[model samples]
Target: MANRLTPQQQEFYRENGYLVVEGVLSREEALAYRDEMHALAERLRAQRTVNATWPSIRAKNPNVHIDHCHDVQFHSAMVSRLIVDERFTGLAEGILGPNVQLHHTKMFIKPPAKGAPFPMHQDYPYFPHEKHTMMAAIFYFDDCPIEKGCFRVIPGSHKLGPLEHQSPADHYLPEDKYRLEDALPLPGKAGDVIFFNYLTIHGSGQNESSEARTTLLVQMRDPTDCPTVQTHESRGQGMMLAGIDPNARIRPVWEKE
Candidate 1:
């Protein structure tokens, strides 16, 4: 596969802890994925899959809502193919070295006018890895402007490593120190994708616009990078996105010795 990211782009990611690439997918492809996401949301709702809106947000504003589903590829074949596509995996390899492993995939739909907001926080508290190689890629299926609560990040915050966070259950930074309004917003067009380190301090505001904000987030890490804790394990966690998993081992649960 061709190099999906240029040298300057890689350097920027290293220095800023986040990088945005435009047109990772074609406009038509993005629209198709967006439609698939909407269909999947309906199916999940029919199945009574729980709402993923943060409890904190609901507490503050009962009217706000955010719909989400984990392991999206399991629900949609198109997503399964997209995850393995060179356009996606090649970019993962460019940042995570040759052996890239998927941690999980989540589909999020922020409804118009009452979309939930995420408080500033680092992803480290959820699932920390020994090598700290875990990162996420957010693919925009529709235009995400600031008013639509596009993602925000604090540049170079990853270099601070894991900082103190609130309760593991709440998982947010101190409001007095890291306010959502202070973070740098990253507005993106359809087909754009943003990659950021897991430790990067980030969040987003509520979607105050009339249009919904749809996105697919994929968390990935080097296969050799071991998790510090066993939390956030998912069915598709160890799937290789690029190259081979050098740390593959037979589990006793699967095959008794």
Candidate 2:
């Protein structure tokens, strides 16, 4: 009944590099978040009206994949407001330890059959950190059935370091020595959360169900870990919190002390 993670959960996370927790949020809360997210996406799409007639919108089509705003800091604030409970931070701190900082936040909405399988990759490979480990929490706002494309993680794969990925276009053939296999789609109900290490190699299967798969992902790291340039934007975008300015002058979020 303690709100903190149990010893067994801690062991699972440390050994397998991931832990699946369920029934954290209520179905009503999850539905509210889903409504808010849909509204946000609609707002973002409407804002493009000025450029609606533009060539890029006409050719490539802007409504393709909704990339949540590229600003990590802003996204964190948004998620904080949505979750709006200290239990989130408490759970994160329990696993990651105190002196932790928000690294990034993202929402992936795999709409029906349109959602494609994400490529298998390790997050740390792209992050500019010398540290080998970081932590992530995934909140499932809706049912995560295998047919709806739930996240899949390779057990005990974090210790193996980053592995090369086969192109999504080509079939992964065993004769070719491709080790990527179907990670068990965690059969889960609404409000389930999956906590994982950054080094954990995880991916999703195609969304074959009629319903959309919506989940929010939050990353946290110890304050001592280094920050990485996760996007192409410059530091002047004013997208980060005041303390999170990427310029040499501002203290990195992880370095807050």
Report the C-alpha displacement of residue 34, candidate 1, in angstroms: 0.3
> Candidate 1's residue-wise lDDT over 45-120, tens digit each?
8978556667777778888888899999889999999888898888878899988888999999999999889989
Model 2 worst lDDT window (10 residues): 49-58
Clashing pairs in 2: none
Off by over 4 Å in 2: 48-67, 71-78, 82-84, 164-181, 228-250, 253-257
lDDT of 2: 0.61
lDDT values of the candidates?
0.89, 0.61
In candidate 2, position 40 carries an lDDT of 57
State candidate 2's TM-score. 0.75
lDDT of 2 by residue, 48-153 (tens): 6122121222233433342243323353444556433555655666776644555566666667765556545567644545565477788888888888878888
The TM-scores of all predictions, comma-separated, are 0.96, 0.75
lDDT of 1 at 199: 94
- Model 1 misplaced stretches (Cα beyond 4 Å): 1-3, 252-257
Question: What is candidate 2's CA lDDT for residue 70?
Answer: 32
